[model samples]
Structures are given as structure tokens and as C-alpha cells.
Target: MKKKVAKFSVLPVVGASIFFYSFSTNKAQDINTALLEEFKTVNEELTFEVPYSPDAAVFDPQLRSYPALGKSYVAFKEALGFKESGGDYKVINEFGYMGKYQFGRGTLKLIGIRDTNLFLNSPDLQEAAFYANASRNKWILRKDIERFEDQVVNGIKITESGILAAAHLAGPGNVKKFLRSNGTNSFSDGFGTSIKHYFKKFEGFDTSFVVPDRKAKANSPSVI
Candidate 1:
């Protein structure tokens, strides 16, 4: 009886096993490194990307720029008159509000203008009437103007011009009410224009020149 022993090199088998293990580990590391590099490349691409607005239309300069109020009193009043009645000197609304500045007969009389047709037809007179009314409103609301100017009310800044403009829209009484009520008492005219809308629209214009005169007349030489 003969016993046979299997003769195989354990070193070769172990060496081959170790070699393959190291090779596979290095291959996996290279793969991970490649994947990481790819990920970093994608991230870098995203880093330079900017979020876009759905409505990114460019704003119009004509619409955004404030009218040149600092140029002249006529320019300022003309700009306001345009908003009031499209600068139409002969315009009289259904509410009996006459001319570009939209003055009622009572208001025109208060400013001492007896002739209705003259106020309506003459642009200069209409502009003068606006100055008179502005002065009157300014005088009436002087304390309120001094107290509320540069203060924020209901998320809108209260300017002197804003107050005067609101007064123009809803009269000094309603403007006072709206101011005292912290803008909760919104007043709209016969034409559906709101006091707050006027306040916002007329903000940031220089109205310091509008002096408070109790007897502000349309023909007043200082009415500017």
C-alpha cells in the first residue's frame, strides 16, 4: 500500500491571491476617484449657474423715471395735470370737476376764481388753480404734514407731497381722517381714485416750496 501527497506551491497561490486583492482594491480606489472627479465637475458647473425669473422682462425707463419736478413749477404742475386730466385744459368730468387740475366749482371759488369757463379753457389758470389749492391744503394740513412726513404708515412713507396729493384726491378732511386712521380709512373720489394710491404715486417729490397760506388765491403772485 502506497500513500501519495499532493505537491502544489502555496507561495504561488498566496502570492497570486494577494496580487489580485491589491489590484482589485487599487482598481476600486481609481474608480471612486474618477466618480468623485465627475461629481466635482458637475458641482462646479452648477456653482456658476444663476437662478432666472419667470418674468424677466426689462423695465421701461420712461415708466420708471420720475418726472423732472426739480426743473420748473410749470413742469411739475403739468406733470400732475397730465395725471389728473391728461393735461386737457377743457376737460370737465361727470363729477363737474373742471379743467386739467380737476377742480370743482366750490374749490375754484374758494381760490377766488369767479369765471368757470376761464378756469377750464386757460391752462395757465388751471395751473394757477392747482397752486392755490395746494397752498390751501398745505396750510390746512401743516401740522399733520410736519408730524407725518418721512414716517411710514401702513407700509408707505408719508411725504408732504404725498399728503397734499392725497388731499387733492379726497380733500383735506378725508386726508386727515385717513392719516389719523393710519390708512385704514381709505377714501376714494367720485372717479374711484384712492387716497393711498395718490400718496404712493406722489411720494418723494419736492413740495417744500408750497407755503402754507390761509388766503391762498389763484392770482397770488407767490403761488408757485
Candidate 2:
């Protein structure tokens, strides 16, 4: 089998003692090289940009070659197709969802971003939404720890990655019952597989943020 590689070209623009870079012609190798360069540049300028390099567990063929962030990006793309706009980055969905995350209008509103168009277009808003999603995940993980400490501690035996992932995607309460009713308890069995699969993609990119669907309340629907 012939291995594929990409060539990368990087141009650095320094202003006000800060270095801003433009990466072009990104193929497989090029993109990876640019990432490493960006990593180094950011470290020199800002001290950090993902302190650890991607590993085999997270950088496997299935995860990295396919959808790394899991189903959310797929869902977002589907939503974009539903909107019939050809997935223009500038366009925001009717529900105020935007970017790769597909953030809803209510989420934007809660964060005080009223203009849906602006939120969709602004890089700032996109970054904020991503961070917010990650924050929600942290809260959820905390809650899971509080309630299901034993399940998690025992190598996710009672809980299963599927349950944890479903909880991560849907909500903890829903996943717990889901596990109870089903005879299976593997992370790969349920929504957990998708969540686990996607997390690596999300972690790979800085622009990407997996905010919890705050609307995911006690009895909220799990469709989104």
C-alpha cells in the first residue's frame, strides 16, 4: 500500500510582539506539520496549546480518519443540510445553531448573544460556545462522580462506556435507566460508543468545543 502525505506551507506574521500564522496547502502531512508548527509557535507566544501530543488510543484510523468528534459534527452537518444552505459557515440555523457544534438559539440567548447572525459569523461566539459545551461536560462528569462513584471506580463495569457516553450525550439520569433496562453494558453498545468516538476529534482541534446541552435537564428529550 502506498502511504499518502501532504505538503504544508506556513507564513508567520508578527505584530505587537505576537505571532499570527496562516497555514495553507494542508493535506495529511502538511496539516500535521502545520499543527506541530502552530503548537510550537503558540507555545513560544502563549505558553501552551494542548500540552500533550495525540496518542495511539486517540489517533487510530477509525477515529482520526473518520469523524473524530463523534456524531455531533455529523448531526450538525445533517442540520445544515436540512436548512438547505449548502453548509455555509456564515449561516446560522433557525434554532440559532452554528459552527461545527450546532449550538441552539436558547444557548446563545443564555450567554447574552442576541443577534443570531452575528453569533454565527463571529469566531468569538464559536469559541465561546465550544468552551461552554466542555464546561457542561465537566459539570456532568462531576455529577456522575457524585452519584455513581462506585460504577466509575470499578473500571466502568456496572456503568459501561455506553451508559457513560449516553449520559454524556443525552443525560446521566436517562443513561442510568437505559443501562438497567438493557441486558448490555459496554461503552460500544449504546450512545456511549458515539460519544467516546467523537471526544477524540473534539480534543484534536482547539476551535472545537463540546459544550453540554444545558437544555439537557432532568426530563429533557435526547434527540439533539
Q: What C-alpha lDDT do the candidate models reach, one value each? A: 0.82, 0.43
Give me the runs in candidate 1 sitting further than 4 Å from their true place.
1-75, 220-224
Residues 1-224, candidate 1: write the lDDT tens digits.
12322235566778899999999999999999999999999998888756786987788767766555563445556667888899788988898888888888888788888788666667777777888899999999999998899999888899888888888878899988888889888888876888888889878777777888989899833232
Provide the lDDT at 139 for model 1: 96
* lDDT of model 2 at position 92: 52
Residue-pair clash count for candidate 2: 9
The positional error of residue 49 in candidate 1, measured at the CA in angstroms, is 56
Report clash pairs, candidate 1.
Answer: none
Candidate 2 residue spans exceeding 4 A from truth: 1-88, 91-96, 145-224
Worst window of 10 by summed lDDT in candidate 2: 4-13
Which digits, one per residue and each the tens of the lDDT, describe model 2 over residues 1-224? 12322222122223422432223323556879989999998889976566786665555566534345444543433332333335455665564446544556565454445566665666555545444443454455555534553343222333222333344344444444433444243244232334333222222122223334544322111112
Best by lDDT: 1
Among all candidates shown, the one with the greatest TM-score: 1
